[model samples]
Target chain A: MTVQARSLVQITAPRQTGPTLLDRMRRSSLLMAILAPLAILIVWECLTRVGLLDQRFFPAPSSIIVSLFALVESGRVFIDAAWTIGRMLVGFVFGAVPGIVFGIMLGLSPTVRAFLQPVIAALYPVPKIALFPLIMMIFGIGEASKWAIVAIAVFFQVFYSTLAGVVNIDRIYLDVASNFKATRWQLCRTIAIPGALPFIFTGCQLGIGMALVIVVIAENFGTQVGLGYLIWQSWQVFEVRDMFVYLLMVSLLGYGSQMAILRLQRAVIPWKKDDAG
Target chain B: MSSDPSTTLDRTGLSPPAFPKIRVRGLGKRFQVGKAWVEAIKAIDLDVQAGEFICIVGPSGCGKTTLLRILADLEAPTEGEVTIEQSDPSNPLSSMIFQESSILPWMSIRRNVAYGLELRGVPAAEIDKSVDRFLALTGLDRFADAYPHQLSGGMKQRASVARAFANNPEILLMDEPFAALDEQNKALLQEELLRIWSETRKTVIFITHSIDEALVLGDRVIVMSRRPGRLKTEFKIDFPRPRRVYDLKANPEFGRIGREIWTLLREEVVGP
Candidate 1:
């Protein structure tokens, strides 16, 4: 049979109506976000005041916010955050660029992959922090050492994800490419890079997460200008409130950076199924 | 329209061609499942003239796909020789419209349609012209800027068809491109495909399990046996040109041919 003629669009736009409760909440997502954290902080502050929690270890949230503001006013938070973020970005750029480059190379060529896979496999399992002392021996305890540790830590995550992404691209797509008689260079440019991009972003996200962990630990050793330095410094001086403030800043950085990456992923790969706006 | 199979040769050129457009002799594929060699297809011989629409129909897992792949140069046949006579050096040898999810999801409809041409490094102006024409022809012009994820399954396959046509390859190889669609979509696409194909009679090798689809689309419907497939029967469909699928099936001869194919295939499908 044949001659079936009609529209292809299965999904029609829903009828618009007055804003429901769910719609209202979705519209005020930013407001909702602020309210939940603020309410939690207020409850914690009240609990501290009532002596329900130990004031020594668990300072009032209000006092911590005050210290946070004071730290901001003194520009200490900015300096520390700037240092930490700067190192993370530098390390991320160096590590991620090479990781993706090598990922594409190894994914495409089995000869090189077979030769180097064992080396990569053996090296990836070792804790990155354990390599820091070895890194310090080479770069010394300074910005170079911090940068090296962060970059090295991030490289593994990005490389693994990029490799997996490229290798696991649907066979049909590659078959399509091959039918068109694409050159190896054309294959990489047209298919491998774009196809592996979603996975590369996944790697970058994990890389950034690890970057934060490594940066804080590396700062604990050599630098006095980062959030990690402030954290360790606060512990030594017993400035519990300052410790809470800096620790809060660390968490904010982690959350903020992850959100920034998600935003970047949305911008870069707007065609991702669930991620499409 | 010449219904004669002999007249199908050399439609592109004024003079008759010295050779067939495609030559496949004793083609066989063996897949290794663990340590054992699994015979996917065995000792297949086929010849397709230029500008001919040939459809191969068989039961599922009959290795028709593997045969199509070998012709497309995506897979190598272990036993025999396969050659595509490329008349023009500039045009690609073959372009395949896959069963599903063949079009790149990351690209917009326009870009996906233009992908093959872009890979071949054709001039941008020519690429744009062909792409625009095929997009509109496929009813995807309105959604030229839309990505594959935004389109329906049928629409995505339409884009894949558009891509193959836009590339203007010498031979078109399709592996059950409509197998994933619903009946309505399948009919619609079938009509559209026949219309497009009539306009440009590129040598086409279509593989499908649907006997009706084969009869409706092809000048010759080839039937193959089960796994480790070998060609069993060949029927020349002498339906006159511009035959619509809806009207053609109503003919008593159409039922006769379909039943003949079903009978030939039943033994292979039912075992012994």
Candidate 2:
């Protein structure tokens, strides 16, 4: 009976209601997002071909793509992308997981929050990039220093946001859960985590982006064989198209990870999407 | 519809009279707002027998909810003791339905109903049976997989009531569970509530601002004064079961009881 009713609804309903005018406009905007970058690349290529723009300074998209293809064929692009992504993941895990755990502990307990939040707030604004030189001085120009810099850069952002999320959860939900005889651990797992998930994810998203930016910059201080190293090496050699290729690689990598995180969020926390819709 | 109405009254008069399943003594509450301490409840006492349907009605800010919270152990009273004769404190003997849904938005309807059982370490098989039973009782089985956001206000309250009853609580404390619903839904839910209450026989302590609701649901309606809230008077209702909430208003007996309670309440509600 239930199956019959469900099928009836599905059969009667329009396949889509068709995309509204607003949806068409949004699709156009997405097209524009793609077109904007293409237009910039085409203009650069045209200027360079016409000798109005110097290929020596600004690289054309086609040239950059050729350089990118060469790097891919040599497996340099794939290896470098893998290495950078690995560093980012490890750094994010080290920084974000512990930061959130401690942040929530501090937020839930005033004494802990009072002791830690001040230290965090004070150190938060200081440019973590400044510590890159110090990290390299100690850890040397190995993977250790790169990973350390990325971890440190991501930590404070995720930590503070987690603290805010825990502190801001509606107290009434706590009261209701408490009255239901929910043990402390159950309350934290079922109520606290889900309640603060969106905020924590927000922090994670920002931290991941910031970590990439900081790690690449830190890598530039002294590095070999990553996207940042490739960019720096190409620029030093005045290989403009190669530098542009590495830069484009970094942007694509970051965009890919962001989409991955968003998809993960939707799967792990379907309720978040329901609340929004 | 028994030939002898009093025979079906279901009363067993015994020596101790089952110790009034729930007893409240010298209940009071105070909240500190910045520099000033505001008293929410003055000393008050009440007793609820097993299977008794009681409604506490008062104006807004009259501490009716605070009183319910005190009974539910959600709020510690400034000065009071609430004793439930046969219930365990470790596992809640009473479950409260708040003014809003409060069914934990993150949980599906089935999980929400099963929450108390889950807390008590009930096996998955048992939780499924109990949740299914209560969901059917409240006519919410159709929405077993739905989230609170997917439900209308009335449906949410039905889920809340089902969740509250899934544990077979000794008492149910409802704080205006239907005040937010439209009149039609409100009446329907009220009738549904009575049917569930009649079958389950759990003692109920409901707090509401609606006099009509009190007249319809309460076996005993306690009128409370405003501000430093106190019990002004009590009315014993002899209305029969399966009472439709709207039909009671047209019955002359309901008007007399309404006026009796209103007489005690009008001064507190209207000032002076």
Candidate 3:
């Protein structure tokens, strides 16, 4: 009977050890995500070393890294990155804050929505980058014009997203507020703003990316301090390695900004569970 | 049908006031659905005594919710008026509890409970005390800091109830508050509601479709007919106070009253 009981215990409870390989892999998924790019870099380095690709156009990964390091050490990278980031942030703030405010107004008042809808429809579809010449005429071919271009690009994105956000708030919440005798201001403060937060974060994410893109395009003309100017200068001189370095920096900056925005969203709106995970 | 004077007097305590807590005179509601106007309710007249628990029961789409909404001042009646007699100038006339979860999703359970008091500009210390009291009463003290999304459906509804009670409204208007809860949770909430109602003695106007629920909770059960709803019948339930919801249903008197209401309700449900 004792022997039978021991066998049953073994069947009921398997001997415990540690996490399985799959569990460990899942835990270190971020490392696996980095591994793919590292493997690609290694293969590209091997291919270049073997002389399978021409060195003139496609420089080795090691040489590109060396160029990157030299660019950073020269202090030019900081100036260019600062210029780009500053332009994006200044333009983004000016554009997005007003956009969100006006969006909320339009969403809450049907009269305002009706009055602005036609004008918004007319202006929203026109590519904001294409307005750079007109903006240059008004603000001059300086930082003002670049800021205008970036701001216009970001404004429409944020405005539309915020409007959609406020408009989509469940009517039930408003009714509940009304039942509690909430004033108009109280309704906006307590119900409307918090309810529309998720969508506003989405708008911010989109607006930032658009601001980055417009800044690059704006810098391509009459700008010398930004990463866009560096890329343009490199391409003009046919320095492919330097151009690639700038491109990589731009990509990294975009990725980093997006991740930062996502982190902010997670922190501010912890109630929104990420079901995708 | 109008309320009986003797029952209203008994519920309102000694030296009953000249006016009822709520007086509805020819209350009617019509909605403009698409192009045509749909009559949701027609000429509802009700006089609810102070400290009375009244349950309004009807078939689906019979405008019981519309009537409750009108009483809570959430909706304007197409015709007629609702007058709430507020004795205290400082207190709000009414607070509503919806059928679905109405606790603010972004707010913690404690914040949601404290919201009404905050809106009323109550002192911070008083708000915190009332919030704590109601949270403990509803058995949600442990989840005070948790967001609504982190709570179960029943707990969220409990938070909603606690919020209304903490506001200390003169009248509580509930529209099928437990309609979405399961049988077990419904029983638990019903008991909690009874306990709270007995202690507070605030005038309650509850709307529900369940006959058993109406019999278990209401001092008087008001039945209404189909769309363009009108009062069909009223049953004065005299179930003793400090009632156990679970045991109430098993009582033979509970079944007899429930069946009588159901019989009156069946004709309205079946048409003509």
Candidate 4:
């Protein structure tokens, strides 16, 4: 009969009376998230086959599959995909790690937060992509420049969410910890980290998306490898089908990664799932 | 002041078997509420015995829960202290059951019961043994792996009790643990509590506003005065054990004791 268990009892007791409209909507939304994409893909394949849409501008799913197979057989696509994934991993690590550390520092100390507020605020709105020329000038359009672009994008996105997470944890839990004679490090490890997990993971998800965007734009500026390079090169040579093939691959990779992260989240936070029900 | 239980119990033919395990001498508590100094408890003195089921009942604004919190060491008293002979201060020897149970939702039932042991740095082997024993004592063995969300209200409270007892604390502090449950669950829990208390023989200080609840579980009921709480009076029930509310209500002594408590409570509920 812990407090949490008692609360669950009270919460479910009142709501068990009816099949409310809100419950129906929640079930419907879950179904839609699963089914809507498949329906659209089917419609897309049909439209392209019947010549209702121009295949040059919008290649059929079958043609994209052929191009994907051709690229994979030549081994160029695997190397490019690996390079893109590797860059994302490196950039994500560089950006998210420092962003989380600094964010925690800022959240813990209002003085530090205040001191850095104006600097972050000024730079946050200036899109990092707009400074690609300056970055190229500084780093000379190598892997370093691409990684830096991705890192810069990731840092700001993660920093804000981490700060919000730390700042919003309930104060009462902290008070309870202190009363129980928890040491400073113990408090942070038990209370602070668990309290901030939901927010931090959210930031990671957002930052990963931003990192993908930067990788494309950064590779487009100058590079001989990566998914972004493939698309840029294909567009220039009138290989529209090849360009669409790269686009579809990148989309699938991004979507698949997000789904994997969500599954990891469920494993890590089973408590939230039970509570939601 | 008379140690002669014979006068109170001999005529009624039930001996007063319980003895006090903790003492409160001239106890008082004060707090600064905004700009003004507010007195929460005024020179309250009471005695609770080993294995004695005692309940402190008062109105909403009265410091009934506050008194229990002080005993639990969740808060320090501004004025006086409570003395428990067996309480080791070096190692925590008192476990509390809050109004809400307060079990960590993230933990499974077995882990929740093992929490106090973990806090005390008990060896893993011994903690596992003790958790298993108390889980059986509270009849939560079937729910060892279940999350808090999977339990019913009565079952959750049972888990909370198991958690408290698993610590092997000398005393247990319960602050309205069953107040939120429906009448059926509340009654069943009360009966289970009596059984557990008898088996474990741990001192219990229970706080509640329910008069019937106080009469049912308490060996000696201490009625407190409204706000600026003080010990109004105490009553020793001469009823026989294996006592349930239904059985107690049927006894002639139950009606007499119930009437006497109603009179004490009426004074506090009304004026003078």
For residues B1-272, write the lDDT of model 3, one tens digit per residue: 01543211122222346788888888788999999999999988898998999999999999999898877767667887666777676777789999988988888899899988888889999999999999999999999999998889999999989999999998999999999999999999999999998888999999999998888899999999999999889999998988888788889999888888888888888954
| Interface root-mean-square deviation, candidate 4 | 3.1
Per-residue accuracy of model 4 over A1-277 as CA lDDT, tens digit each: 6455444433344545666887776779677687877888788899998989888888887787788788878989878988998888798889999888877878767899999978998999998898778878998888887888889899998899889988997764554454344566656665666667778888888988998888987888767899999989998998987898889879977877667667776787666644231
lDDT of 2 by residue, B163-226 (tens): 8888777689999999999999999889989988888888999999888899899999998999
Candidate 4 chain A weakest lDDT stretch, 10 residues: A6-15
DockQ of 2: 0.43
Q: For candidate 2, list the clashing residue pairs, or say none.
A: none
Q: For each candidate, how many residue pairs have backbone atoms clashing (under 3 Å)?
A: 0, 0, 0, 12
Against the reference, the lDDT scores of all candidates come to 0.89, 0.82, 0.87, 0.79
Tens digit per residue, CA lDDT, model 1, B202-241: 9999999999999999999999999989998899999997
Which lDDT tens digits does candidate 1 get at residues A177-258?
A: 8888788999998899999999999999899999999999888897779999999999999999999998888899998998
Quote each prediction's TM-score. 0.90, 0.89, 0.91, 0.75
After superposition, candidate 1 runs with Cα above 4 Å error: A1-36, B1-18
* DockQ metric for all predictions: 0.65, 0.43, 0.62, 0.14
For candidate 1, give the lDDT of residue B104: 90
Those runs of model 4 whose alpha carbons end farther than 4 Å from true positions after fitting are A1-66, A94-200, A221-223, A234-239, A273-277, B1-43, B47-52, B82-90, B266-272
Collision count of model 3? 0
lDDT of 3 at B37: 96
CAPRI classification of candidate 3: medium
Q: Who is ahead in TM-score, 1 or 4?
A: 1
